[model samples]
Target: MSFIGIDLGTSSVKAVLVDDRQRVLATAARELTITRPAPLWSEQAPADWVAATLETLRRLKDTAPEAFRRCAGIGLSGQMHGAVLLDARDEPLRPCILWNDGRATAECAEIETGEPASRAITGNIAMPGFTAPKLLWVRKHEPDIFRRTRKVLLPKAYLRLVLTGDAIEEMSDASGTLWLDTGRRDWSDRMLAATGLDRSHMPALVEGSQAAGRMRPELARELGFDAPPLFAGGAGDNAAGAVGLGAVDPGSSFLSLGTSGVLWRTTAGFEPRAGSAVHAFCHALPGRWHQMSVHLSAAASLSWWSSMSGQSEAALLGELGGQIDRPSPVIFTPYLSGERTPHNDPQLRAGFLGLGHDTDRKAMTRAVLEGVAFAFRDGKEALEDGTSPIGEAMAIGGGARSDTWLAILADVLNLPLRRYRQAEAGAAFGAARLARLACTGESPEAVCAPPSGEADIFRPHPDRAAAYAERHALWRRAAEVSHALR
Candidate 1:
């Protein structure tokens, strides 16, 4: 039997078909647009997501009708922290407020004032990217819509509701909304009181691998399949990526370099960082939690630099490859779109420090790579608390495609970086693995195994590690200066 995994991302909806042995059979994607009618506000029509999902599934059916018909189960993974409000009739009241939209900063501030109690109750600090603040924003500004709201769901959960008609969310995705009791794996009553919402407005919570429902007969027919079992409640994109990369075990970790960059570490129990810098979320793996450090601009920064300079990422890396032997004094702060972990400041901006006449494009490029590494290190230190050192971390996404960047990351992290054989498909592949486990009643390890590839291990050189440590201190100082100036 084959399994289908659907990743409903911020920019597109992607569907992948994988065989029982975990080999991808067919893939399809449909891009969707985010509308910004006003500054700092981002929205997407829920109908648009449904339409794209349908079209993407249609493409998958067209690609291999026989394989599509043999699909045994379907799983979903999507962007986290987006708010999708539904009316009593289950119709969306308005366009979803996306994860990137920052209009709820004021509400975030209000929630933070009660941080001590909030953290005790929700196991997280309020952030504009979370769902509660966005919900409050809707409640305060769009009262009529708020009154009509019957269900509050995340991006993927909304899609899951449409797919399964169950109106439920998984614990992994719930952890991102700042409304979940991370320790208990349930919605926080304190958060509900603070937000002036009731528990009834939220969807029932399920474990990541639990079967939510069967595919709607209509959707099944559309995809040329019988009613396949639907595992609608999978996980947030990051957690799903971890599942994809086989980073489900404690001490297993991975770095994702997608639109956002993240350093994910799986742990057995809840280990909340004293400071709310790192996000502690429920992992897709049963009874496990993951701590994450996020960089808002990871691959995005590289993309911007490459696009502005009219250089392909490969070309830029090729140019910088020559300068790796020579150290440059320049240091870049990868806060182009502000920052997430370590420093939760959105007003902060990217900057270049130690630049001089001798600084060249190659040096600048190196700084960009190291800067992101430094940010990751900052988050690592905050989350580590001298508890457990990450033994090895798998690398995925576009940034991992570069050996030089991997070297920089390995040196800065001072840990072995293992490049996955199947790169850039972490989320989709993970969803398929989860679907397999759900359908077959097998352990994740039995269903998912690390792919065999040429291993490129980067060990830290003592000298470079020391140099990076020094540069990290300077980077922290620069962040303080930048924040003050703002």
Candidate 2:
């Protein structure tokens, strides 16, 4: 039998077909646009996501008809924390307020100040990226839509409702909404009261692997097959990525370098970090939790550098390789999009300190790489304080494709970095693995055999590690100065 896994990302929706033995047969992808109507506001039509998902599946069916027909189950993973409101008739009330949209900062502050009360309900402080704050934004600015709302679902849950006629949310995705009790794994009545939203408007909470419902017969027929068993409840992207990296056990961690970067580790039980340096949320794995620290501008910073200089990434890396004659004295702060971990300071701006005419493009490139590594190190230190010590981390994502950057991360983090083979394929593969386990009664471990590929392991150089320690102190001071100015 075969299984299908879909990753509904911010920029695109990707579908992968895999057999019971965990071998991928074929893949399909469709990109969607994120519409920005104003500054600090990002939105996307829910209909766009639905259309893209259907087109992707149709393309997959044409490419692998046999695999598509033999598919026994389907799984979904999606971007986290977007708020989608629907009217009483299940029609979208407005474009979804995306995760990166910071228009709800004022509302977030209000909820944060409401503190102990907010904590009592959601087990999390209010943040602009969460659903509750976006809901409040609607109530204050677009009260008409808020008034007509019958339910609020995150991005993937909204798509699932359209596909399967089920209005249920997985715990992993719900935990990011600031409307769920992280400790209890359920909707927070206190939060509902605080947000002035009735609990009835929320979907029922289900475990990530639970079967929410089967695919609608019409949807199945449209794709040229009978309705397949659909696993409505899956996970947020980060949680799904964690499963992809096999970070299901305590102390196992992964570093992701996508448009944003993150350092995440899985744990057996819920453990919220004090002061909110790291976000603690439910994992896709049952009865487990994960802690994550995010850097809003990780790979994006590198991409920006390439675009500004009109140089390809490989060419830039080659130039930087020639500059290894000596360590560059420049320090960069990777806060172009604001920071999420350790600092949690959204007002801070990116900067290049200690720059001189002598500082060549190589030095600038090296600084960009080092800056992201420093941010990751900060997160790793915070997670260490709250949970088990991180001895090593598996590197995945577009940035991990660079050996030079991986070496920088290893040196900065002072740990061994292991690059997984299917770095970019993490979430979709993990979703497929989850579906296989759910359908065939196979253990996740049994299904995810050790990846077979050459892995470059970077060990920390003691001298480089010491150099980074000293530079990190200066970076922190510079960041504080920048924050104060803002």
Candidate 3:
């Protein structure tokens, strides 16, 4: 039998076909575009997500026709916290509000005010990027749409609804909504009422590895499958990525450097430290939880600079040659899309300092890399919290491909970074593991093993750690300056 995993990402939709042996036989993807109608608002039409996902699946099937026909389970993973409101007819009421959208700053405070213990209940501070606050924003600014919203789903759950004809969500994704009692792994009525919502508006909840429903028969036939495959309750993208990495054991940790950056660690039990702006949420597997320090921009900063400078990331990175022994004199703040984790300031903006006439493209590029490293260092410190120290972590994401950036990251955080084979497969592969578990009823431990291969470890350069520390202090000062810009 084979399994399929689909990752609905911010910039694209990716689908991977994995056989029973856990090998990824084929993969396909389609790019997606975000609409920013206003300065702080980001959105995407729900139809675009459906279209991209379908096209990617078609491509995957075309690439490996026999494996596609043998697929026994399907799993979904997607960008977390996106608010997709649906009406009585299950039609989108408006474009989906995205995780990076900062239009709900006021509503975040409103949610905290309405539910005084929201932080305790959800195990996460209310942020503009979370799903619940986005709903509150819709209520106040787009009243008619909110009034018509009979159902609310996260990005993947909406996609699941289209595939299975059932509205289902899993613990990992629900934990980001500010309505779930994360410690209890369920929804909190008080948190719902804080946003004037009720259970009726929420999807049926399930563990990420459990079977939620089967794919619709007609859709399965159209895709050339013999029977409708069982659908697994997949996870929020980070949790799904963690699943893919087999980082389920307590104390296991990793860093994700995709569009957003995350320093994640699995926990033995519920651990809430909202005061530090660290996110505590349920893991995809049952009886597991995790903590994360997330920065809204990581590779995104590089992409932005690349676009503005008319230079490809490859060309710009090539200018630096390799890892430098000293820090860039220039310092950059990676708050291009506001920020989260340690700051949670939606109005904070990105900036660069210490630029001189002598500064060239190489210096600026090196600064961009170092600036992101500093941000990850801040996240590392936040995750420390007197316990749960991360001795080393596996690196996974598009940005992790850069040896220079990884070397800088290792030095700045003074921690070892490991790279695995197929790390780039990421969340989609993890979702496929969930699909296999759902179909086979296998123990997560038996199925979610780490990939087979010797790993590459990037050890920090002791000689350069002190210099990076000094530069990190300067970066902190720059971030403080950015806080005042709004």
lDDT by residue for model 2 (1-486), tens: 888889998878988888866777888999888887986678999999999988888887888898897787888899888999999989999999988777787897777676456654554556777889998899999999999999999999988898889898888999888888887898888777677887899998887766776788877876776546567367888787877777878767888887788898887777777365578888886788888887878887897788987998788888875314224588888887667777765566788889887878888898888888888888888778744678888888788888888888887788898986665687777777777666766666676554567877888888877878778888778777668765
- Models ranked on TM-score: 3, 2, 1
**Backbone collision count in every prediction?**
1, 0, 0
Candidate 3: which stretches are off by over 4 Å?
none
Candidate 1, clashing residue pairs? 244-430
| Candidate 1 vs 2: which has more TM-score | 2
| Residue pairs of candidate 3 with colliding backbone atoms | none
TM-score of each: 0.93, 0.94, 0.99
lDDT of each: 0.81, 0.80, 0.93
**Residue by residue across 1-486, what tens digits does model 3's lDDT show?**
999999999999999999988989999999999999999999999899999998988998899999999899999999999999999999999999999999999999999988899998998999999999999888998899999999999999999999889999999999998999999999899999999899999999999999999999999999899899999999999999999999999999999999999999999899998988999999999999999999999999999889988999999999888868899888899999988989999898998899898988888888888888999999999999788579999999999999999999999999999999876799999999999999999999998887679988899998898889987887898989998897
Q: Which digits, one per residue and each the tens of the lDDT, describe model 1 over residues 219-247? A: 67766786656573587888888888878
What TM-score, to 2 decimals, does candidate 2 have? 0.94
Best by lDDT: 3
Q: After aligning candidate 3 to the native by TM-score, how far in Å is the CA of 396 from where it should be?
A: 0.6
Winning model by TM-score: 3
Q: What lDDT is reached at residue 468 by model 1?
A: 77
